[model samples]
Target: MQINRLFEMVYLLLNKKSITARELAERFEVSTRTIYRDLDILSSAGIPIYTSQGKGGGISLMDNFILNKSVFSEEEKNEILYALQSLSIAQSPESEKVLAKLNGFFDHKRSNWIEADLTPWGSGKDSQSSFSKLKEAILNRRVICFEYFNAMGESRGRTVEPLKLTFKVYAWYLQGYCRTRNAYRTFKIARMSDIVLTEEHFEEREIQGGLTMEDDETSLLSLRLNVTADSAFRVFDDFSETDIQRMDDGSFSISVKLPESNWLIGYLLSYGDSMTVMEPKHIRERLREQAEQIAARYQ
Candidate 1:
């Protein structure tokens, strides 16, 4: 893949000190034009890469430029390698190869200290394919079309310029500019289907804040939840120990801040009777109404 080749090219320039475009092409088994494009990609990403033409001129990084000031330090190098190793769980071939190259460069053997698998439990082949496609679209700045199911169970077609693929909580989200909405929006990858990569390209728009992992202070709701002992495993898994209080009665009480959204409502409802919303009466009432509606449906 071109991404892998681009990474290898950097690694090569680091080790060989310098190399001609033709030599890089031969090494990668690609055309000189393709090699130049790869070099452009590296340069655009702020890698300080440049081409010099003349006697003893070739592709190389800026002299005296280390990968980063801290990158050569053993602890920092291991931290970077560990981060890459975690990212490789997504089955990103480029990241895996880059990790291998970095390991060799640092003369460090790979350690299985950390593992990050973003895919949900029991996720199938389709999930992997969707993730791979989203990654490609985001990288290529390509527009993509897909059918999306929204929170209220409404389905619609969306044409968006894929910008970022985010793995948050237990699901994957795509942050993109939606042509239909004329706004930036986040789409849950699980709710998307028939995803098609369009030939049409979009000018990269500066992404305004849309969906982010950081909780917005203005919209965040401070919550208190009292949970039965039976829900301790779920509570501990989702909340940090600092937010959790073990009650004298062996129950668990958690104080946390969450972004106010319908998803939060559904999440809280998932606990059923095992948990009680101790504060935020509005949220509790909403869940109560929904529970009543669910009971009505069963009746």
Candidate 2:
């Protein structure tokens, strides 16, 4: 931890030019004595850290000192830039600023080591706008209200304490405390409309284990699907190589784990006659009934 603190102290000096011992202590949540000791450690390590004890004086790095590229190995620097660039994909202005600052620190030109555009094709403009608003609300601890449409096609107004914006499976979701439901809910950004950010701030609540930012890997249902050759392109696009197998008839069999929900049913239906549920009689029956209903309507 001390080693991390020392690195942070150097970064702070590099960014802020100078800071008071009291300020450093408060920033790191350590005592002035501890700050002084860390300064001694930096100075001994030839970091060019110096402190002046007078009015308008504070701890500062030498004006000529530039961070050596060796401090961050080339791979490590690339990783940091890659992370910032990924954040920028969400259209985050702050991420762009920090990314530029970090590049400047290393005296490196912008490198296209990685590019991440998480939005699906034809889905960027709206998703980026929603992500920006949700990110702002989360950072400012503001309450947000939006009209949410559920899978059942019901629309309702929701007031939530925006907690986190997550990018999962090529879509953005807002996980927050829903005042209407009296529980934490994950609202898909695509289904949200009429976004309103309230000026009222909210104190952070202790998050439940199930409702944290991490994705739930449990509760997965194993599904078997038979895909016709006509839809094999769609199959390859959606499924990983390991989850699919080619049959002698030129069809494809896909066995995958997915969260069992209405969304799963809808996703299967979207594939139409080109795909069939090979197992799980209940799911197959449900799909068959839905198809029969549609046929009856046409008849």
Candidate 3:
């Protein structure tokens, strides 16, 4: 705690330029003697801190002094600031305050090198609340309950001890221990609703490895597809450039491996007429059947 107080004292001095010992004492709820001791500690540690007894000056750092010189290399300082900046995506107020203070302490201007927002397009307040609550639950080791929809669109209540929140591929997922199934499971955040943070807490568990979108590794499928120029945006967004070949007609040919799941057909169908599967006869037949079902519904 004293170390924290000492760091804050230096931060305060850096920003305020000059403040009396009595002021810091009151702020830290300690005596002016303790403040003087802290100042002495700082001075002995090669911090160019000095106190003045005149009417104007109380305490000040040397005009040319920089904290980075004593504590961190230039690269280390930038890395720390960049990490804190990245954490801004979480919308943490405490991180923001520490970020600002470090920026001032390092005398470095914060650069807008990276911006990250996990909130999806057209998502509402409930989405943000869920994300924040999940983060809190994960950090605090609290159990969470939510209505989760499986790939087949069947919804059921789940009580889970959330371990981690991860963004893989195009979506966010919560990896947790499911109490109902008595196993570790990963749930897509988008399909989760009615999320509740419970007062129950659990000891952290050792995570089993080999987690994947599909539990059956044998279900992985290799496919080749022809994408029209009209779907160029999605082609570039979803596939690596190396995996895509430019055709003579401005269409693209892509070869990629993906997990075979109930939603796989639906995902391919989302490309509509702009894409066609060239390989995998079974998938093509399934897609055609699904299309016929949709047509019958409309008819």
| Cα lDDT of model 1 by residue, 190-217, tens digit | 8899999989888987779755422132
TM-score of each: 0.63, 0.64, 0.69
- Taking every candidate in turn, the Cα RMSD to the unseen true structure, in Å, is 6.9, 6.5, 6.5
Candidate 3 per-residue lDDT, tens place, 8-79, comes to 888888788799988899998999999999999999999899888979879999889776655688999999
Model 3 steric clash pairs = none
User: How does residue 60 of candidate 2 score in lDDT?
Assistant: 95
Task: Indicate whether candidate 1 or candidate 2 has the larger lDDT.
Answer: 1
**Number of clashing pairs per prediction, in order:** 0, 0, 0
In candidate 2, what residue range of length 10 has the lowest lDDT sum? 210-219
Question: Any runs in candidate 1 off by more than 4 Å, and if so which?
Answer: 1-20, 26-77, 212-226, 236-269, 276-299
Candidate 3's C-alpha runs over 4 A off are 1-70, 73-75, 212-224, 229-232, 240-262, 292-299
Query: What is the lDDT, from 0 to 100, of the residue 152 in candidate 2?
Result: 51
Q: Could you arrange the candidates by lDDT from highest to lowest?
A: 3, 1, 2
